[model samples]
Each structure stands twice: as C-alpha cells, then as structure tokens.
Target: MALNYDKIVLFGDSITQYAYNVNVSPFCLGPALQDVYTRKFDVIQRGYGGYTSAHAKLMIDKIIAHENTPTSKVKLMTVFFGTNDSTGPSSTIQHVPLETYVANMRYIAEKCKAADIKVVFIGAGPFNAHQWWPTRPGNPHNRTTIQAREYCDALVALGKEIGVPTVPMWDLLMEAVGWKEGDPLYGLEELSAENPLTEYFVDGLHYNAKSYKIEYDGVMNAIKQAYPELLPENVPLRLPEWASLTSPDVLEKALQ
Candidate 1:
C-alpha cells in the first residue's frame, strides 16, 4: 500500500514494543492512536526490547532518515527511554550514565525539531523492586523508585530546557495508584494471578492492559496540553466527510 498519511513515530524500549502486542492484550497504545487518527496519521512503532537511550542516540539519525521519505512525512515523534537506562551501572549491557542519558535525550529532541517534527519525552515508569529483584538474583537490583524518580526529574528538566513536551510517566503512575515515596515497596506489589495489583502490571516493570490505558491517557493528555494543534480534532481529516458528498463522484468531491 502507498504510504498516504503523516507519521507519528514511537521510539522506545520493551514497554513500547509491547504497546502494539494484541496477543498480550487489546489495549495497545500504537493501535489506539492509529484508530483515532485513522486516514490522517500513521502511528509507527520503533520499539526495541532492552534498548537504552545510549542505543537510541546511536541510531536515531538513521531511523529518522528512513522514516522521512518522499511519501511519508514524520509529523511527530515520542522518545520513550530511561527504563533500561536507569538500570544499575553494574548491568553493563543496559546501564547508561545519568549524564549521558540527559545528553542523549537532548540530542533526540534537537534532531526531531530540526526535522520540523513535534516531540514528546516520556519519563521512566515506576519499577516494582520487590517483584523484579528476586528474579535476577545474580544481577544487582539497582533500579529503585528513587533512581527512576531521579531520571524522571532529569527528563522533565530537559523537556523544559528544550521546549519539548514531557509525559511524566513515573509521577503519573504513582499518583494514579495513590502511591507515595518512602512507602514500603513504593506501594507496588509483585503481580500475581490473584493479586489486585496484577491489573496494573504483568510483572513489576511491564504494564498490563489496564496500566496501558493509563499510559495512553497520560500521553494523549500531554499532547493535548503541549501541542494542541496536533490533536485529531484540530487537524483536518484525511478525506472529506461522507455526509458532505452531494454527488456520486466521491473521488472528485474528495479532491475538491
């Protein structure tokens, strides 16, 4: 099929990869956005499992170049990282220095701006230490709510500095669930079939369908508040409304 609509690219890690997994659940954020913007914008998923901001920084230019083709224009991009980057320094594979994380985020936003694409930065979501810690006993559990908070704050600060919209996923999830800092386990529990909190996450770090709904809400809210002009209601629909057609020549009417 010909590429016919402007694109909204979602670039991130495992969470983003799963955001479009209908097999996991039906509340996939990418599809949800595509449905809302049907015929207007194509939501592109560029999520790589276990990727960090450092990895993203390395390939962002090429990714952008590939997406910015003659037929497909990138209208907006969301840079969602920090989950893996917040891993402890000992986890050499995923850990990126906090300073490097900030720089990478800035580079991403600057690149998107240069492409004339609106950008949003999503902070790391809350990590359930209690659930994830025991599973990886050999690896140190350095990712705490505290560490995630620090990274989230840095992203927010970077957004302000660069004039980009930021979705404070960490704080948004905490407040949604009535969680407070210093609470035991950060008020998050390991997900179990019988546990009430299971609706929020499949494990401690990944979101379930219900939790994805919250995430979708946060992202849309951020876009509406920060880039209202991009909202579907504000932007023109790709085709003329069916009711507006007065003649049998639909294509002619649409072109007009």
Candidate 2:
C-alpha cells in the first residue's frame, strides 16, 4: 500500500506532553512513534505542559493558521486533551464543560480536514486514583475512577460527530488487569521499574517513561486501525511477555 502523509502532529496538555519535560524533542508520544514512522514521516510533538482544551485551542489555531504549509506536508494530527481539564491544583480545576471542549476539538478537526489531514482524537487514558494519584477527593487511596473516563467518552462522542476517528484509550486502560491483586491497574512501582529511566509519573498527573510506552502503544494501534497504510510495512507482530498477562480479549480486539 502507498503511504498516507509525511508528518504527524500531537497536541495536548502535560500528560499529552508526558506531563513534564523541558526543551525535549521526543516529549512522549512524539518520540515513541518517531522510531516507528522514521522511514515514512516526521512526528511533531507539540505538547504544552498544564494546558486545558481551551488553551490547547489557542495553540492549535496558531499551528493550523500559520505553521501549516501546503508544501511542508503533514498527513495526520492526533489530539489528546481533557486530563488537565479534570485534575491538578494549578489546572483550571474544573472539567472542561462538554460543549466548550467539543467546540475546541471541532475547530481542530475542521482545520485539519480542510488541509486533508487525518484527525484522531485519543481519549484520555484511565488512571487508578489509588496508585496514579496522590489523593482522591474523599478517599485518599481511591476516588471515583470513571470521571476522567467519562470526559474521554464525551470526547469520543464529539469525534464521531465530526467524522473524526477516535482512539479509545480509556477503554484500553480500563480493561487491563492490574499488575497485582490489590491494584486494578498497573501500580507505579511495577511501571517505573519497566526501565531504569522509566518513572510511571512525575507527580500524580503526568506520564514518566513507563506509562508513555503504554500510552504510545494504544495510540499507534488506534492509528493503524484507521490508517493501516500509514504504518511501516513488513513489521512483525510481537507481544511483550508481560503484556500477555493482561486480559486476552481486549488484546485480541485490534484498536480502530
């Protein structure tokens, strides 16, 4: 099959930017997918830390209006927001009102579509309040786990309305069997140890290194579903040993 586009754009909050990193080229999703797309495309990681969908709208507007050049060649733009709109002291501390959030995303979708660029909305991933967060609202160990997921669901709805493809990352993380019995998802310790440089979270809100891998895999799989031609040809199918430990059913259903 022929390739789709020549560049990929990633826009979101700190978590979208891997939560925390300065002057770093490969922030998170950008770097992880860079290697995978090396032969065919360039990944532009436009991850601004601590931004809500409202803020993201401003930046994306600029890129679409100014930075995007017909001659430069950009094929896709994957957007992942809503995390900051839900949590963090410094954040707006309020869920982005569904209407406003969807509008911002729509702005992005319309712009990219006009340019013939594919738009993929990556629903924010699931997070275990007990492990990933320092404290829950009432329960220190665990608060309601599905609120963020719910916001992600709204994003999915918005994407569908605009005819944009969505990566159901929330479902992927929610369905995963925890690394251990007590934890319903992988714990920080187990995740951080995946690699020496890996730290599951910088605070309780952003990805370190290990979690980035998990996030990247889900998005890539999602992209493959919507645009198979964009993926590297002749890539072998292989699963990490530990990944087999998760629910097989979810693993078997290829992301689309």
Candidate 3:
C-alpha cells in the first residue's frame, strides 16, 4: 500500500475556501502551507462558502473522520469561522445567534480534542462595510466590522476558555489599516479612495494577496510557537528524497 501522510485540515467558510487562489495568486495561506509541507504532511481544506459556525459543527465529524484514521492522522486543524456567522438576522441565511455561534465553536473544539488533534482558531476576520455596501445598495447590510469584531472577540475569549490558541485575523487586519478602537465608523461610501483599508481588501470584503500574506504569516507563527514539532522545517519528508538514493536497489528498498 502507498504511504499515507499526516494531515493538517483548514476548516472554515469562504475565506478558507478562497485561500488557495484568491486574486489569482497562490501566495494565500493554503497554497503557501502546501508548498512548505510538500512532502511532510498533507494540507486538507474544508472551506464552505456561506457556512456558519453551526454548519462547521455539523461538518466537523466528517472532516475529522476523513483524516483522523489509524493510518493518516490529523495533527493540526485550523477552525476559521465567524465571518459568515456574524451576519445579522434577516441579512443572510447563514447568520447564527452569538450564543449559538459560541456553542457551535465549542462543539468543534471538543470534537478535535477527543481526536487528540491540536486546534487553532482563526476568526472574526475583518470586513469593511463601507467598501462592501455597493454590493447591496438598497438592502440591509449583511455584515459590519463591529459585528465581525463582536464574534471574533467572543471566539478569542472562547479559545482562551477552551485552552486553544487563536490567531486574531480581524484585529491584525484592523491594525494593518490603522483602525483604533472606539473610532467611529463611516457610512456607506464614506471612505476616500486612498483609505488604507483599500490596500488589504478587495471590494471591502474579500482579501487580496497583501492581506493573505498576513494570514499566512499568522498561521506560520501560531504553529511555530504552539506546535513547533509540526513546523515544515522541523518535519521530515515521509519518503526518502530522490537525490538521497544511492543505487536502484536503495531506491526500491526505500519505496518498499
């Protein structure tokens, strides 16, 4: 039988889904990880656009079971949600109550814990309503920075309570654009075209290459600190390197 590699699962909504090819660049988190982990461990993406925490909880079992088997175990999992979960009621079909969001997140952590997998939470990723407002001019705004922060903060606190480390995507992006706490938000289309927020965001909602680099750095740093053993540099390739083979017999033996 072929060798089965260990797994690193990225579970979340559209952000996770889009990480591989956002803005037509593989510089995003998913591909960056796979590049580093090419022969060490497989990176499995479970991103679902429009998925809420409740949806994540429901899907966790399948995700875990898919990799956390006897042969190929899941060593790490990034639970990235809350962007869609932060949607206000009557705004999007994916919205879940804050309390429900907390409960669902907890459920996902518990599942990963039971499987002996290390979990990292990435949440409440930043959003710019002013930049996003044009998408739905007359309709109710589906999400805002404040609401996203509400859920992200809750998730951060939840991570603390659950003893899991969290990567603060929302805060990092906000700070990148120099957003100070207690700053008043502008109405739709209020920001100047030259606003710093325009640099990291595409259409005020999706991330471009620059912002994705932030995400890649955050994930690598989190792993470097919390689970150094899983770092790409530290992990050995499962199979022998082709250049290391001395003879045809050695190569055949290594394969066997």
Candidate 4:
C-alpha cells in the first residue's frame, strides 16, 4: 500500500511499545488515539524496551528520517521516555546521568523541531518502588520512586525550557493512583497483587489498562491545548465519510 497518510509518531521506551496493546486488558493509548483519528493519521510506535535517552541519541538518525526522504510526513511526535533512564546507581547500563539525560532530550527536541515535527514529551518514570523492588531480578533494585521523580521532574522542566510540550506522567500518575512522597506503603516490601496501586500498574512500573486511559486523556489534552488543529476531532478524514457518498460520481470526486 502507498504511504498515503500523515503520522503521529510515538517514539520512546517500553511504554510506547505497549500503548496499543489490547491484551493489556483493553483501552490502550495508541489505539484510542488511532480510533479517533481513524483515517486521518497513523499512530506509529517506536518504543524500545530498556532504552535510555543515551541509546536514543546514539540511534537518532536511524530512528527519524530526514525530510528529503520519500515517506509519509510525521505531523506530530510524542517522545515518551525516562523510565529506565531514572534507574539508580546499581543499573550500570540504564543509569544515564541527569545532565546527560537533559542533553539527550534537548538533542531529540532540536532534531524534531528542525524537521518541522510538532513534539510532545511524556515523562513516564519515578515509579513505585514498593511494587517494583520485590520483583527485581538481581542483587540490587536498580530504580526507586525518589530517583525516578528526580528524572521526571527534570524532563518536565526541560520541556518548558525548550518550548516543547511535556506531559508530566509522574505527577499525573501519582494523582491518578493516589500515592505520593512520604506516604506509607502498605508493606515494608513485596506488595501483594491487591495493593493501592494495582489498578493502574502491572508491576509498579508498566501501566495497566487504567493507566493507559489516563495517558490517553493527558495526551489528548496536551494536543488540544498546544496543537488544537491536530486534534483528531478537528482533522478531516482522508476520504469522504461513507454516508456522504450519495452517488458514484460523488465517490469519484471524493477519491480525487
């Protein structure tokens, strides 16, 4: 098929990769956006599991094509990262220095802006360690909610500094899940399946169905505020609506 549609590219980590997963108990982020846009824009996912901003910078050129390239135009790009990047000292591979993370984020925003792509950043970290710590695979739990919050806060400010819009996932999730700093965890460690956060998180990090819904809501709100013209409801379909085709001639004209 010809690439006949403009796209909304979701470029980030595992969060982006799983945005369209109906198996995640339905109500997925990417699919919700795609459904609303339908024929107007393709929702492209470029999420890399375990990738940090440094890795993203290392592979930037390959991930984003130049304008000279013959391909569908990318109307908007949502950069959702920072989960793994928020890892603590034990995470030798995933731990990106705060300054470096900021620099990498800047590089990403600059490149996309130069390409004339509308950008939005989604800061998806500063996770709940109470839920994630016990599920760790090794000697040290490499991430903590405190450390994640530091990185998430940095990204939010960085977005404002660079004129790119950012969706503050940490704060949004905290409010949605109703947990915050210094709040007593239900346990010392090892959260049960039915903790205060189970409704939104699968493992204290990855999102469950409800979290994706919250994400979709925030994303749509950001688009409506910053790029209202790009909102799915505001965009026109690539083809005429079926009910509008009263005759073969009308259909032919619409196709042209």
Candidate 5:
C-alpha cells in the first residue's frame, strides 16, 4: 500500500510519554519514530500519564479536532492501555471486564478509520507475581499472567474484527523474558539492582526506565513488521552505539 500521511502520532498512557523525558536507550521511542518515516514522518507523543483507554478516547478526539487543518493528516496511531484498569479494586486479573476493553478499542479504531488513519493496537504484556517481587499479597496492583494473556487475546480478536493491525506486546515481552530470573521485570542482578526489577511501574502501575525500553522496542518492532513501506532504510532497528555509552542514571538526568 502507498504511504498515507506525513505524520505519525503515538497515543497511549505513560509508556508512550517516557520517550519525551528519558534517554535510557530502551525507554526512548524517538529513534523508532524517526526510523519508521525518516524526516517525512514526525512522531508526536500525545500520551498522558495515568490514563486508561477511557481517557485515551478523549485525547484522540481532542488531537484530531486540534490538528484538523487542511494540510494536516495522521498516517498512523497506536493505543496502549489497561494497566490502570486492571489495578482497580474490583478489577479481576482478566481486567476491567474484557468486554469493556474490547469496546473501548473498537471505539478508537472506528474513529481512526473514519479519519483515514491506520490504527495499531497493542495488548498488555505479561505480569508474573512469581517474577515480580514488589507486589502486595493480593497482587492487587498488577494483573496475573493469565489475566494479561487473556486481555491481550481479546484485544487481538478485536483488532481482527476492526481490520487493523494488532501488535502483540505481551507476546513479545514473554518471548524476550518469559519469567526468566535475570529478566528486568523480575531480575535482581547487580546491573538492575540500583533500579527496581519490577516490570514497569515503581508501584506496579506506571513504568520506569527498564519497562519503557521493553515496551518501546516491542512497539517499534511491530510498526516495522506491519508497515515496512512507511519506514526508511537508514533508520536503525536497535539503539545507536552512543545510546549505550552513557550510564542509565546520567542519561536519565540529561533527559530531565
């Protein structure tokens, strides 16, 4: 298919916002943004902190209304949420009612389609109480592996119905680590000792640096796989050499 728009907007929660404030190589989605479209596409991070899909629906409409100029067009957009919804007291591991999650995603997909914007949906990643050590007894803050997997499956099914691409973020994370001891989600190695080993959030809700990298990488990989025509050849698939030269803490400071 031919390229659609000149701009790519990233829409989601804190995970999408990490790139604007962090330089931890993995946490940064700027590289991926540039890679997908070279200079032709500008990746704008429109993610809000602590937002669920319910909130993202508003953000999307607002962005479209604000930027709906004659020359403006959105080629692509990605939406990721559900962590917050899963953390609610009444929420089960299966998430804030699987039906509700599907409904929210469908709503987003419909609006994007109407605008002629390609939409990509990402499922929630795996969360293991056994892997993550920083959780309460009830695992109240985090969803279980079973729950995460089921939610992702539901999202994927929704993607099929809506005829949009669905990136399996949860599957990618599981393939990358899969409850491994040294995995950042639950790893306790000296390298990750200073930083918390929990999946993404300091409290199991929001994301930290490590989780940011994992999610960003997964999202980029998905974009490349599904929309290769939209990306430039010179753009890198991995972090640049310089990105690894700086210490994580120093990189974090620079972003501040």
Candidate 6:
C-alpha cells in the first residue's frame, strides 16, 4: 500500500487510547473524524493510557516517526494530557509540578511545530474530587475540579503564548453537565450518576460514550474556529463525487 495519506494524529492518555474502542465507548472520536474526512485523511490514535505530559514529551518523536515519511504528512496533531499530570504531590509517580507541566507542553508543541504539523491542546476534563478520592483510598492521583481548572487555564494560556489552538475540555465538560465553579461540591450533585448527565461519564473521572460525543463536538468547534481551512468542508474529498458520474469513465475522472 502507498503511504501517501495525510494524517491527523490524536496523541494523549487513556481518553485518546479508548477513543477508537467501540466496546468501551460507542462514541469513538477517531472513527467520527474518519467519517468526516473519508479518504482525505487518515486519523491516527496515539494514546498511551496513564501517560502524563512529561512522559509524552519523552516519546513524542517515536510516536510521530511513522508519519514522518516523504509520502505521508502529519496535517494536524491533538495533544491531550494533564489528566494524569495534574496528580497531587502525594501521588509521586504521576504528579508533574505545575511549572514542569507547562514546560513539557511547550516542548511537545515545539516538536510538533518543528515537524511542520499544526497542533492543538486539549485541557483536562472535570472530575469529582470527593467521589474520586474515597474510591482510590491512598491514591492521590485523584484530582479535583478546582485543580483541573488550574491546569486547564494553564493550557489555554500556553496555547495563546505559543500560538497553538486549544480545546477547552474542562469548561466544555462542565457546561455539558450544567456545572458551575462556585457551587457546592462543584455542583457534582446536579450531574450525579443518578442524574441524566451521568451518561456522559462512566466513572466521575473518565468519559462514557455520550461524553465522548460532546468532546468530539468541542474539538471540531475549536478547529473550525481557529483553523477553518482544516475543516472537512474546506478540504477536497479524495475522489470525484460519485453522484457526478454520468459516464463509464468515472474512474478516469476520479484519478484526475
């Protein structure tokens, strides 16, 4: 097979890894993007479960190496991290200091830019600290909505400083569940598992199928607003429209 496909790589942690897993999440972002792009671009999932931005920074080159071919081009890359990196100091392994987190993100973005690929950053999603902490017991990787907000803000700021596009995952997820910042329990009760909004998240930490769909929409919206040219509507399809065929020489026209 010819390695000539333009690629859009989704690079991140568990969320990105499970993006293509229909069994786990019926709303698969990779497949959704594939449907939109059709044969115009290959959407590649490079998700590493439990990986922090620091870890990703170390492996970015290897992760992107396959698409560095002369015949293949990396058209866009989405860097979704901070879920694990936001782990508190008590969680030694996964915990990346806030300063280091910003630096790691910048490094990753710079690497992508150096490769001539457009990059977008996705902020961490919402989590229920009270529910999450008790479930994990001694695990301090349990991050609160407040902490995630800080990281998300940092990501947005980094995006502005570095001139990269960003998807506000934290804010968008909260909006999806009708959550507000100052409300008690961060308004967790409003979107409790018993609530209809619970369908968006299986656990308070990870997204379910419906939640993934919301996330997909947010990402597409970001791309549309910041890089409209990259939108599927603007990109030409891989071949001629089938409905336009009026003769047996359709294949010849498509090849053109």
Q: What are the lDDT scores of the predictions, listed in order? A: 0.82, 0.62, 0.82, 0.79, 0.62, 0.80
Stretch of 10 with least lDDT, candidate 6: 187-196
- The clash count of every prediction, one per candidate, is 0, 1, 0, 1, 3, 0
RMSD in Å for all candidates: 3.1, 12.5, 2.1, 2.7, 10.9, 3.1
Candidate 4 wrongly placed segments (more than 4 Å): 1-3, 66-71, 137-139, 180-195
Return the candidate ranking by lDDT, descending.
3, 1, 6, 4, 5, 2
lDDT for residue 46 in candidate 1, whole number 0-100: 96
- Residue pairs with clashing backbones, model 3: none
Give one digit per residue, the lDDT tens place, for model 3 in 109-215: 99999999999998776776667777667877667777888998998899899888888888888777777877744322444535677677767767788888988
Model 2: residues with Cα > 4 Å off, grouped in runs: 1-5, 19-28, 88-95, 130-144, 178-202, 234-256
In order of appearance, the predictions have TM-scores of 0.89, 0.67, 0.92, 0.89, 0.68, 0.87
- Tens-digit lDDT track for model 4 on 178-212? 76667754322454445566567777788878888
Off by over 4 Å in 1: 1-3, 185-198, 245-248, 252-256
Error of 6 at 81 (Å): 0.3
Model 4: clashing residue pairs?
126-148
lDDT of 1 by residue, 1-256 (tens): 2236788999999999999888886787888888888877889999999999999999899999999988778988989999999888888999888899999999988888898889989999877765665677786666766678779999999999989889888888777777666654362333332323334766778877877887788788878998998888886787777887767787575665
* lDDT tens digits, residue span 150-235, model 2: 67888889877777778766565545433333543433333442322113445445565556666777677766777776676633
Q: What is the lDDT of residue 28 in candidate 2?
A: 58
Worst 10 residues of 4 by lDDT: 185-194
CA shift at 118, candidate 5, in angstroms? 0.5
Instruction: Give the backbone clash total of model 3.
Output: 0
What is the alpha-carbon lDDT for the whole of candidate 4?
A: 0.79
Residue 99 Cα positional deviation in candidate 2, in Å, after optimal superposition: 2.4
Give the per-residue lDDT digits (tens) of candidate 5, residues 1-256: 1132356787877767665665443446655556556546667778766677777665677787665546667777887776555544455433356678778888888888888777778777655453444545554434555566677888888878767778776666656554444455432222243332254544433455665667666666666777766555633333224656567765555334
